[model samples]
Target: MAEVKLFGAWGSPYCCRIEVALKLKGVEYEFIDEDVHNKKSPSLLKYNPVHKKVPVLVHNGKPICESLVILEYIDETWEEGPSLLPKDPYERAMVRFWTKFLDEKCMPAMRKACLSRGEEQERAKEESTELLKFLEGTVSGKKFFGGDNIGMVDIVANFISYWFIIGQELVGLQVLTKEKFPKLGEWMDEYLNTIIIKENLPPKDKLTAMFQARFEAAATATATAAAAGGGGGGGGAPK
Candidate 1:
């Protein structure tokens, strides 16, 4: 077996994707947790100079960056457990298509709702809800994206298992509803219910606290900016 090592931030679902893949494959490796926000380590920079982000997988002394790419690498490298991807070329293509859609299309709206406020947040909430319905279409008639078992799509969509809660809470809006998206909502339950997935997930309370911190900081910055703008606009007038 090739020596494997993972460098990642515990709270990041992207990191968790690769982690779950390795576990499901029954691969053994070392794990290193980076101080995601406050400290930037030299090793993180050296391994992923371009992105300098978490979830970099090092296989046999070579580093693989990007969550999806690393997922494919691990799947292809190990031949145990269920395949991360489908063997059928058409199904594989479909899996890849939806995964890309989640990253490129769904993620942006989700991020906008999570990080932005006011009109932008509301707009993102609307976009996110529609995008989620589209995602539900992808689920179709399967227990998971890989049909009976969890696969690449399940790993890639791992964010929805947990982070979706934080996003909705942050924006104070409802996008994913059981009535509107029964399939996808059930998929979320199935994904989380999977044993390895449930065990490996970051603590929900910590994740929520982290997001709440972001919201509070953004609010403070907006308030400070408004105060500065008001003071600057009014100070030139003589009493």
Candidate 2:
């Protein structure tokens, strides 16, 4: 049996993070696709009892949950190749800080945009725009988040490369357009063009279609709730 195994879903950007890290580290692992939305496998539950989430990396029967944590574990375990964290303590701290920012602030905004409509959608768009602007400013003259080479923070923040673009298409928003956020847009191109990142990303049209279906399903659920008179006690119809 393979010493390392990864439980993941195809459409999950979280899963993609671990995949990229493992590939970058040149670790050979078994890939298990878990149906995150529907039913999870027994192994997934056994591995990650707390979150029961995908992207669980099981090494020698011990499981590591959370994509970021798994990346750190991989980095520490496999000391070969380019380092994910910076050598300097301050630079490493900055990387962690930005990665946390992307996870907490940027991801939430993007999720909101995915599941929202009307005023709520507008608010999400605004928030996403602000987050993108902040990221753009941070990258002002830097080649990558880790300065010269890609690091853990860059790998973690890479969801903005393909997933965010898919989110824009699915949610029918243009928050990260070239005109609105040119620097960020350029940065996205640069990131995606990188050898490791480019090779690991999912197919564009396929991801777009998957997200579109999810968006429509969420909208349908909202409409169904409104029809059943169980929607947040609103006077007007769903936008």
Candidate 3:
């Protein structure tokens, strides 16, 4: 058996993506939760020298950085069950296109919603709505992004399903609603109902409490820093 290890964080949706992909593939690997904010471990630095990001997968002592890259590597390595990428070249390219789009467009809106304030927060909300609209339009009739079974693009896009709900509460905004985005709302239900996804999700109550506390703490810190005349500005909100 190859020695597989994963460096991740508990509350990060990015980390959850890798965990879900690994579970869906039924791959056995040791999970090492890293303190991404506080202090990263020596091994995490050694493995991911470039980005120093979490969700780094080490297979047979070789490191794969970035969640999407790691997911692709995992799918290619373990070719037993469901395949992540489509067999058809055109379809595969389409999936890659959407995955990259989600990372670039959708993800930035989420980040802005998480950390921004005042006018920045309003701008983030507008951008987030546009992205959600695009997603709803795209997934109108598709069973999954891959057409049937879940695929790499679906895995990457799945973050919006669960994490968006938490963001709704944390950011004090409602981006997704059954009335507004009915098709996407139904798609979220289908995605969550999948046994593999449902089984691997973090506890809801626990996650809610975690996010709520984090938001409150950040708010308090921001207020305190402002009162102290300290400089801590810029960057979009959390997702």
Candidate 4:
């Protein structure tokens, strides 16, 4: 038997990606829930000293950090299950390109749309919508990014189907809507409905509650910063 363990935070979409991959591969792993937001665990620190982040996969005493890296490792290590990525080199490269676009381009813009206010929020919303439009075209006439089944792109984009939806709802920011991007919307519905994905998802209510708290904290921080900036404009002289 192989010794497989995973260190992850419950609410993180990045961590959830790894969990979903492991499940898809039918790999039984011991999940060590770590408080990534509050305090770091000794084991987590030891395994991922540089990043000190969650979603670290330890297989046979060797640690693999980063969700995307861990996902490829899971797929490669377990050959019995359905392929997470394509075997063709060019096809695999395309998958990596889109995943990178999602994480680097789409996600940040969507997050900013939710966290920023006024002009910045509008810009972020526009950017996110444009990025999503590209994805809409990519997924057009397809049930999934993998053509008919879940694949690397679908797994990497897990955040869009769930986390981003909940976050945009909490902030009342609508960068992604079925009316605006129907193809991507349909893809989301299909991805979320898959038995494996549906079974593995964290409870929606719990995820929403967590997002609400984070949004409140961000609002408080922004207000405090604004107040401090206003107070500091005294021209270094007492009038």
Candidate 5:
């Protein structure tokens, strides 16, 4: 068997995507935890010089970075698991389209809401819900965006299943609810409750605390920057 090792962070949804892929494939891998806050590992830099981020998969001494790219790689290399992408080329393209939308639109908006305040948070929440609504329309009847079973779309949107909800709670907003967005709300519930997904999620309480800390840190950094700006000579010279 080719040696497989994963470089990941505890709270990273990106890392979880790779982990879920490996688990579903029944492939055993050594996990390396990256401390992204204080100091990133040299190997992470060496492996993924562009991003220098977590969820870098080193397989048989070669490194693969980017969660979505890593997922494609895993599916292609290991034939044991269910296919991540759909069979029909058009369906595969659609899956890729939705996956890209999640990464580019919905996820980033939710993230902004989680880490911002007041008007900015409201704007982010609004933007997030709007994109989510678009997604709901796109994958309306599908149990998972990838279909009846979990697939690439499901894996990429996994953040919506747990972290997005947790982030909403931590930030005190409710953009994704059953009443307003029935399809997305139901999909989140079903996607999350699936056996492999449920077992592999970051604990809710722990994720809450992590986001709480991040929110505070962002607040502090913003406040400090504001204070420095106010005190600096950028304004007209004081009398």
Candidate 6:
């Protein structure tokens, strides 16, 4: 029997991605839920000292950090299950490419849109929508980003199907919509309805509440900072 353990947060989409992969691969892992909003655990720190983040996969006592990296590791390590990456080199390359675009480009812009206000928020929303257009086109006529079935890109893009939609609603930012990206919306519906994904998703109500509280706290902190800056700057013009 293999010793497999995962340190992750219940509300995190990153963690959910790993869990989905593990389940898809029929790998049983001990899940250690971490309170990422507060202090992290010593074990998590020990595994990923640099990021000190959740979704760390510890297999046979060796820790693998980062969700994407861990996803690849799981796919390679377990040969019994359905392959996450395609067998063809070109197809695999495309998968990696889109996944990179999602994490490096789409995710950040969507998050910024959610967290910012005014011009900044508008800019981020526009950027996110533009980024999503590419995905919309890519997934056109395809049931999943992986084509026909769920694959690496589909797993990596799990955030778009659930987390980002919830986030956009909470912050009153509408970056992704069915009307704007019909193909992508259809893909989301199909992907989320899959047995593996549907069963493993975080409870919608719980996730919504968590995101609501987080957005509220961020807004409060931003207001407090602005008020403090307003009071201080009037008294001094760089004295």
List candidate 2 stretches off by more than 4 Å: 230-239
lDDT value, residue 91 of candidate 3 = 82
Candidate 5 global TM-score: 0.91
**Whole-model lDDT values for every prediction:** 0.81, 0.79, 0.81, 0.85, 0.82, 0.85
Backbone clashes in model 5, listed as residue pairs:
none
List, residue by residue over 127-236, the lDDT tens digit for candidate 6: 99889989988999888877787888999898899999998888777678998989988998899999999999999999888877777766676677678884211110
Better of 1 and 5 by TM-score: 5
* Minimal lDDT window, size 10, model 1: 230-239
Q: Write down the worst ten-residue block by lDDT for model 5.
A: 230-239
lDDT of 4 by residue, 3-47 (tens): 999998888888889888988888999999998877999999999
TM accuracy, model 6: 0.93
Task: Write one digit per residue (lDDT tens) for candidate 2, span 102-160.
Answer: 99899888777767777877888888988888888887787776676778877887778
TM-score of each model, in listed order: 0.91, 0.91, 0.90, 0.95, 0.91, 0.93
* Candidate number of the best TM-score: 4
- What TM-score does model 2 achieve against the real structure? 0.91
Task: Supply the TM-score for candidate 4.
Answer: 0.95
Q: Under the 3 Å rule for N, CA and C atoms, how many clashes does model 1 have? A: 0
Per-residue lDDT for 114 in model 1? 66
Where does candidate 5 stray beyond 4 Å? Answer: 228-239
The predicted structure with the larger lDDT, 3 or 5, is: 5
Model 1 reaches what TM-score against the true structure? 0.91
Superposed Cα deviation of residue 228, candidate 1 (Å): 5.2
Q: Enumerate clash totals for all models, in the order shown.
A: 0, 0, 7, 0, 0, 0
